[model samples]
Target: MTPAARLSAAIEILADLSARRRPAADALKDWGLSHRFAGSGDRAAIAGILYDTLRRRASAAHVMGSEEPRALVLGMLALMRGLSVDAIAALADGGRFAPAPLSEAERARLADSSLEGAAPFVRGDYPQWLHASLRHVFGDSVVEEGAALAARAPLDLRINTLKGEPEAVKAELSHLHPEPCRFSPLALRIKLDSEGKAPPVSAEPAFLRGEVEVQDEGSQLAAILARPVPGGQVLDLCAGAGGKTLEFAALMDNKGQIYAHDSDIRRLKPMHERLARAGVRNVQVRSPRGAEDVLHDLEGKMDLVLVDAPCTGTGTWRRNPDAKWRVRPGALAQRTAEQAKILEQAAHYVRPGGRLAYVTCSLLDEENGAQVRALLNKREDFSPVSPTENVLALGASGPALAEAALTSREGLLMSPRRTGTDGFFVSVMKRAG
Candidate 1:
């Protein structure tokens, strides 16, 4: 299919999403199923256009002075892709299967539109409702920070040191041109293609052999911050699909006891296969059996307890832009409540002198520092570990990470603007022995 036809399909999918108030991925998938004649490249291109449009939705609407689907596609072309009036006009020329010819108003907006007096939410391409929360966290630079989140995220992989050394694994996947990440020594970054599609790393021999696992650099840093010692007892209280659980296994070289459990058993299903593939033996999967306490026996026995708590996912907008728009204030309230409850539950597993690490993919202060502060308030035994000390686990990268991150009295905040990573907040607390 031609580029124009792809743009038309993207516009249709966007309209569907707006009307149904559903995820863009679902709408795109349904569109693909119905339009079977479109080849793989065509579907990928359409999906790319759809996602780029979503990423720039607010800004595009601001620039075009319209929130309609066609206006968004045209504005996205001009703003995100930097297409000229003539360039965009060519794609909307009304030649069969193409979008209708651009109206004089659209052509004028495309030529003259700018974000010059736009509000922070408009300039940042994020939902307007989130402006206050983001401003509270980023201050005057919220626009810059939000714009960074609006950009595309690079694909990151963590080398499973238990399987192979970094250099050895790097050599095996050399065809993909992976580069070492700036902060995490275990991380390698892969740039998405020109069309914003990630290379099929899952098909690579190294990945298949469990030499590398797909993980964001910020997440790798979060796991590293836990600072679990080899032969220590650790509990991953909210180990959804066990991303950090696998990381903990590698960090301990499979020596320590690591019990991974989640409130929902369905979320833990993929972990068994992932653990086996990664050659991890330290982790024991504890699936919830009805209302029975799955981790009752292990309470108060852990050397480290990790709460990778659920949140609004504001930091992950670069990867899931659609979520930024879909998130609501009610949802934020629900997540914070859940996070508070989870933190209380996770604290029970941490023995005296052990550490509790709180993590979130959100950039909101309420879900991060505020939550940590509240936890410290409730538990007199737990005191926050200094950000300076937390970085010690990273070795040579420690100082660099310290300089790159936003450190608070309660914890460290990593964002795409500050740390060149997804937005993540991590705070470690030590329970007095």
Candidate 2:
């Protein structure tokens, strides 16, 4: 596909996103199905352009003085990707299957437009409503944090230490072995070149043998922050597909038990196969059975409860850029409320002196710091614990690194900027006796 054709595809997808309430991915998939002539390169290029435009839509609109897809594509090219107007015009010039030529007005607009005072647009491309919340969480470094959110992310894989160690997996895939991830012991960070394509890990022998799982370094770190102890009873509430549950079992050396429960039984069904493939034996998949089925016997008996609660997933905008465009304040508030309920329910399963870790892949404070604060405020029997200390105490890492990574207080909040991993908030709480 020509560059202009990619822009056209993005425009069509953006229209679908704006008209209906569908995700960009779904729309792009539908487009791909209808336009079967597009090859893999064409599909990827179009998808990349669409996502990049979504990531900076607000800012692009500000510069172009229009929110139309064509204007957005042009603005994004000029401002975000630094494509010159002449270059874009050349791409849109008389060519087969190319987009319509750039209008005279568009050329003038591109030349004269400046985004000097558009603080929200230039800083992070976020809506104005999010400024206060973002500032509340990031303080003075909100701009840098927003910039990170706008950028692309690399593919990260977590070595399934249950079947094989990281070193063994690396040795097996020696040719394709990625750089060691700084934030996660199990992660291998695969950096893509300017072409923006990650190598196919599924085709790798290590992946086929269940030696590694393609998970973000941030996600691997979030699971690690839970600090599962060997032979300790653990509960992964909201364990969708059991990706982290597999990690939990590995952490436990397949000893003791991990009760993996989710409201949706259909979601946990696939995990049975995944666990088998990974040689995970310690997990017992439990369907909610209308909340009481899994809740009755597990009350106040767990040593560790991991609440990988649902949220807006703002931290993952780099990978799922279209998500930023779909997020609304009301939806975020609803998610926050649900996260609180999940936390409260999961907290009930943690016995006195047991630990409960609340986690989310969101950059929002309401889902992270604020949720922990609310839980602490509402529950008399729960108190904040040091996450770094808990992990170190579990023998997760050496004392020197633990001391460097953790605060004098216990809660561990990892920013993508700080950790070079996913934006994750992990708050460890102790159920007071």
Candidate 3:
């Protein structure tokens, strides 16, 4: 398909997503199923256009003076893709299977528009309702942080040290030009093509050998900060698919017991296969039958309990741009409540003098600092631990990682602008002995 046709397809997908209030992936998949003639490359290009448009939706609308789907695509091309007026015009020319030509108003909107004068939220391309939440965490850095969050994210892989060294895995996957991440000693970053596709890591021998897993650099940091002690007890309280659960296994040298459990059993089902492939044996999958499951014996015995809690995922907007627009005001309340509940429930399992690490892939303070503060208020036995200790305890990656992340009162708030990672808030609190 021609690039013009791809843009048209993207516009159609965007319209459907907006009208039906569905996820971009669902809308894009439906488009693909019905339009079987579109090859993989065409579908990828269309999907890329859709996501890029969503990434800068508000800013692009402001630049085009309209919030219509086509206007967004045109503005995105001009502002983001570096396409000139004439270049976009040639594509939007009334050729067969091409988008309609830019209207006179669109041409003018694109002619001399600048985002500098737009509202801060509009300039940041995030939901206007989230301005206060973002400001609470980022303060003066909100716009800069939001812009960075709106940018595309590179693919990150965590080298499973239980299977092989990062050096060995890096050599095996060198064709993808993987580079060591600045913040994670075990992580490698891979840049995707313009169509926004990573190499089929799942099909690679290295992945099949359980050498590297697709995890974000920030997530790697979260797992690393947990610093689970070898021959100690650790519980991944919400280990969906066992990403961090697997990391904990390696971090503990597979000598300690790691229990992987989630509130939803369906999400935990896949961890068995993943754990098997990763050559992990020390981790146990707990399939709970009811609200009260098999974790009773673990109470007051666990050395560390990590809560990778449920969140609004504002931190991962770079990869899932549609999510930023879809997040509702009610979701903040719902997610915060859930996070608090999970943190409270998980805290009980932490032994005295042990750690309860709370983590979220969210930038909102309500789900992060506020929740931790509430917990600290309710549980006088627990006190927040400084992440500086974790940073200082690192062997070689300490200085680089220490410089990469920011120190937030909640814990370490790692943002794309500050840490060159996805948005993540990590707070480790200790239960008194």
Candidate 4:
């Protein structure tokens, strides 16, 4: 397909997404199924255009003076891809299978449009409703932070020490030109292509042998901060898909007993295969059976309890830009309530003098520092570990990550702008002995 045809297809998908108010992946999938003649490259290109449009949706709309699908595609081509007005016009020249010719006004806007006087939300390419919450968190630099979140994310992989050494695995996957991440010693970063597509790392021999797992650097840091002891008792209370659960197993060198449980059993289905592939033998999956207290046997006996609570996923916008637009105030309220409840439940499993690590892929204070404070208010026996002590687990990388992190009274917050990572807040609390 010509670039113009791909742009037209992206516009069509965007219109469908806007009308249905659904996920971009679903919209893109339906488009592909219906247009089977389009080759893999065409589909990937269209999906890339669609995602880039979404990432800069607010700013693109403001620049083009219209929220129409075509306008967004044109504006994004100019703003994100650095296409000139003449360059964009050449693609939209009303040729067969191309977008209709650009109107005079579109030409003018594309030639002169700027975000100099645009609102903060427009400058940041985020929803206007989130401006206040983001402002509260980032203060004068919310626009910079949000713009960082709007950019494409690099693929991050954590080396599974249980199966392969980091240096050996890096050598095995050297074809991709992976680089070591700044913060996590076990992490390697793979840059997405110019079109914002990640390599199919799942097909690599190292990945197939469980030498690496696709995880965000921020997530790896969060797991490392948990500081699970080798041969210790640990519980991953909300171990969805067991990403961190697997990390914990490898960190302990398969010596500790790690119990992984989730409120929903369906989410645990993938972990069994993952654990097997990662050569993890220390984890025991506790599937919930009709609310019959799946984790009752281990309450108050854990040396470390990790609650990777659900949230609005504001920090993950670099990858899921559609979610930032779909998130609503009501959803935020629901997540905060759920986070508080989960934190309370997780605290019960932490043995006296043991630590509980609370983590969220959210930048909102309500889900982060506020939640930590609320937990402390309710549980007098639990006290927050200082940000200084939390970074100790990271060793040489600790001081740099500490300097990059935003320190709060209860925890540390990491964001794309500050830490070159997904938005994650982690607070470690110790239960009284």
TM-score of each: 0.99, 0.92, 0.97, 0.99
List where candidate 3 sits over 4 angstroms from the true fold.
none
**Order of all candidates by lDDT, from best down to worst?**
4, 1, 3, 2
How far off is residue 223 in model 4, in Å? 0.2
Show model 1 residue runs off by greater than 4 Å: none
Residue 135 deviation, candidate 2, in Å? 0.4
lDDT of each: 0.93, 0.79, 0.88, 0.94
The weakest ten consecutive residues by lDDT in model 4 span 291-300
Residue 426, candidate 1: how far off, in angstroms?
0.3
Q: What residue pairs are clashing in model 2?
A: 386-410, 387-410
Q: Tell me the tens digit of each residue's lDDT in model 3 across 1-433.
A: 9988998899899889879998999999999999999998898889889999999999998898778898888999987787888899999998988999888888887787688778889878899999998888778878988899888999999999889987878898989999888868788999988667777789999999899899998998898888799999999999988899998898888897998888899899889988988889899888788866689889999999999999999999999999999999998899888998898899899999999999999988888889999999999999988877666546677766666677755588888998889999889899999
Model 1 CA lDDT for position 218: 97
Regions of model 4 farther than 4 Å from truth: none
Global fold similarity of model 4 (TM-score): 0.99
For candidate 1, write residues 1-433 as lDDT tens digits.
9999999999999999989999888998899899999998999899888888889999999889999999998999999999999999999999989999989999999998799989889999888888999999899999999899989899999999988888999998888999999989999999998779898889888888899999999999999998989999999999999999999999999998999998888999999999998999989899999988879898899999999998999999999989998999999999999999999988999999999999999999999999999989999999999998999899999989998889998999999999999999999999999
The stretch of ten residues in a row with the least summed lDDT in candidate 3 is 390-399
* Better candidate number, 3 or 4, judged by lDDT: 4
Decide which is better by lDDT, 2 or 3: 3
Q: Candidate 1: how large is its RMSD?
A: 0.9
Lowest-lDDT window of 10 residues in candidate 2? 401-410
